[model samples]
Target: MAGTNLKCRECATTYELEPRYVCEQCFGPLEVAYDHSRFVDDVGALRRRIQGGPQNIWRYGDFLPLDGPPGPALRSASRVGLPAGCTPLLRADRLAERVGLGEVWVKNDAHNPTHSFKDRVVAVASQRARELGFDTLACASTGNLANAVAAQAAALGLPSYVFIPSDLEEQKILATGVYGTNLVKVRGNYDDVNRLCTELSGEREGWAFVNVNMRPYYAEGSKTLSYEIAEQLGWATPDRVVAPIASGSLFTKIAKGFEEWLELGLIEGSVPTMNGAQAVGCSPVAQAFDAGADVCRPVKPDTIAKSLAIGNPADGPYALELARRTGGAIDAVDDDEIRAGIRLLAETTGIFTETAGGVTTATLAKLAARGDIGADEKVVIVITGDGLKTLDAVRDTFESYEIEPRLEAFEAAVEQGVHV
Candidate 1:
């Protein structure tokens, strides 16, 4: 009653907190359900504790499901967790103007240690895995999660196995392997890898598949993003938040974070509407939204936004319900628009993001153009990863001019309208 428990999102069946992510009754996804009565009646003390704690997600430890004090793991002669959150929330006036909005902000999560928001989830998963007596950790990743899990496992000195699609970005593959974890490349897509991991999870004992067995704890990590955003925005919630959808967990977690804040009296006003973006080539959730269907039909992914290419999203139905309940819309854009989105964000905010971020940015523009998002509303676009990881997506989208190191040659190139 004091701590947390696993609650079925569908049947409301509650179970004792354990290394489980799915309910036995309805086979629904399990979520961490905290007893709000444990929180102190004094909001000021809570606020001060959060503000004065570590400069990371641990500052909000009370909100997370962990044993004892929720701190980072002391491994590799250093700390391994607690540094994955507290990313900057930049006031993107330039981006807002370009998107025809009165105000905009970018929750730049690329600043995480692993250069993606996955670090937050992996940090918690690694810690929880160790606490649950797991000496090895594993997951089925697209790209960013592989980099994050491998890096975090290395830092924690735990043997890790990451299953990824064979055709993931070279940068992601190299980065993940550099962590020295066992990297498995499947010939099939992410869904196939995920299925294999699920099978492996049932076969292997003491191996905590972060996104499988320890998913409830792992997913709780994403709530820190919403907490950080509200704290950075003067303890207020934004009117809208647009995030790219892969499995749709992050999107729903953001909404849940805001609701928790309101329940705890940590923030005022209603929760923000949740907008989701996806690449057209792999947009099951967005397609479901467009067709007014509650179920998402899986599609074969063929987009440069590989990070957001989970065709069979586990949280697709919940994400769709949240979007509709909040009066928000889900949309998809083609590869060209995704590339243009990356350029537009870079030109305006100087933040180069991965193709998933590009999808979110471009979708924001599309929503703005259609007057779906009001021009006078305040919006925050979530940039989930750094552009450096997916450089191939933009390799042919821009060009640089070569000139001799002479003043005349430079002048000639400038006269020819060469990009500076």
Candidate 2:
């Protein structure tokens, strides 16, 4: 309700709040613009208001792009669907020591309703769709978004369709299909699936494509992660943030969230040093960043991190700008390092993450090894999804000894150094 208009990120041209993601003039991406002047008068009151609201993302409804006032009524209606956000911000002492960092925290977003951060975006987008009088919910996903969209649509009792690459992980496919959505598996990569959805969105009226037509509002959902992180940290910002990049929306929006709060005098710090992580197999953003280029060159993905396999990220240019401006860098890691990253995080923090998080953890370790992060910097690595979604990534990573149910056999196995 507080959103004023949809403004072009490049041209600054504005349009009435509609389900539009591209500017008609420059064809640049569009995003939700808000009027925060009302909350500037009393910072304490605003903080109290947010703290006293719902325990989910709706608590920051003043910052979201909804068309209605955020309160008990709105939250009650939203509760019928999967309420997202309010995930834990855990301090990982062992993880920090293992990575050679002085202080490290884990924003474990895998604890969301769909076991991924995609639930945050879909919650906002689907609510906006209902407000706009859309009949059906739809999206094009690599994996996690499919599960989020399907589950959210089912909760809202709406007919939904989810399109994903046919080669996506079977665990993610099964998780999505269980929600009773019309799952369309196309024989292509994530880019191909996205292109097809863009075309379909144009032809299908009354169907709200969450990530296509409704993207401007959808992307705003990621800002809640920043809000939560800041709120959880006693209204302060971390020294650095290490997060994965897919469409680059989540990476850039997290910075935007911190910026918005800092500008409003709500949080006490500049935007964190924003380090982005990527799988080397599909890391166009990292390549562009490393080469000092302003534009990203698309590539065919060949990584196990399917959730982050978007080669031509829509926000690639913006992600590069943020990483450089904040004295941060976007780095890539190989598949071997990614698997090792998963194991490292699990062994240290007891949090098993999907490949996207693995990419982030690996990049953090790489940064630590290369002396990119200072010893005293308070770093937060965002784990976006649960490991169960991409179970194959850890299939052969660790040894599992199968011996008869006997103490002698177990002792012998331990003697052979199998247990450790």
Candidate 3:
């Protein structure tokens, strides 16, 4: 287990690390807790080891629940999983200018193999599933996760079952089905599909539902994003980070990652402000934060950001606590604002992010406008998925000029502010 154990988030009890995500004693969420001493005796040694390891998430194998670093045999594309992580952290000077921030950067996870941040989580879960003797993989996804799990399972030669809302983007559905998995389209939202998957976990033997059963390991994948940010910034933490909130796991895990690095003396700065973004149509976590309450009130999703439409966010309370404790805030934006955000980012930074990214970007702008974000503070916005997957959200929002293929027609369109 690499000296890692599963510990209850609410209770102080710990158990052996396994394919477990819920505590048997208190039923609280189980998280991977590590014995940090095993990974390093000193900060310099840890840095060297991590720097010398694999370029992907495996570089931090010492912190993960893996048996060891992935062997050389598992390095290529022909193997079980494609290398995920170490995505670019771009300096968005133009985006910063547009968003009214002194400095802004983007940890663009759209570059991942599945074109979403879900690839990182799925990679860890799939590897651990193999170790735990599970030959099949399954998940209830929004869109990005469906693509990641299905593609990863196909890569590993595992039969997979992926459940999703029937109304997800066609690009995402096509992407998942092409991976050759048993793609099941449920006629409900993500939470509904998730509930059904939980029921099936008990009935279906020898199947690993990545998000439902292997969540502890799966969620740990998000910590790698924080690690990459710190390393990419020359081993320093940012002043603030804005992340989209769906199930709230990513935002909380990012806070966890920063804490872990600070504990290990890898980074010296105080924890950054942990802000969250959500669509107004499904902003339970944001609403709870605004009300100064711990309990998130669920609402049926009615937003174009289907990826962030988790009405009942699983880690809502934890995310709310982190935001409050870190002196940060959570905010929500409407669908029109989210669309504007998508165009703003692509126009300013040339990063075509999906609706989740739109939520984060739009919320960041709102925060900046409200003077919540300091003009000199360094900020990083996490872009979780690619815009290509959700083209429907912005298809009618744009126009293509049907003009004659002549220089005079182009000049007239350009002069009249028409599409050229």
Question: Which candidate number would show the highest lDDT if scored against the true structure?
Answer: 2
lDDT of 2 by residue, 1-420 (tens): 879999999999999999899999999999999999999999999999999987889899999999753455654443347888999999999998998889999999999999999999999999899889998999999999999999999888899999999999999999999999999999999999999999999999999999999999999999999999999999999999999999999999999999999999998988899999999999999999989999899999999999999989999999999999999999999999999999999999999999999999999999999999999999999999999999999997766777889999999987897752
TM-score: the better of candidates 2 and 3: 2
| Candidate 3 stretches greater than 4 Å from native | 76-80, 417-420
lDDT of 1: 0.89
Q: What lDDT score belongs to each candidate, Candidate 1 first?
A: 0.89, 0.94, 0.90
**Clash totals for all models, in order?**
0, 1, 0
Clash pairs, model 3 backbone: none
* Order of quality (lDDT): 2, 3, 1
Among all windows of 10 consecutive residues in model 1, the one with the lowest summed lDDT is: 73-82
lDDT of 3 by residue, 245-325 (tens): 999999999988889889878887878999999999999998998898997998899999999999999999999999999
Q: How well is each residue in 166-282 modelled by candidate 1, as lDDT tens digits?
A: 999999999999989999999999999999999999999999999999999989989999999999988889999999999999999999999998888988777998999999999
Backbone clashes in candidate 1 total 0
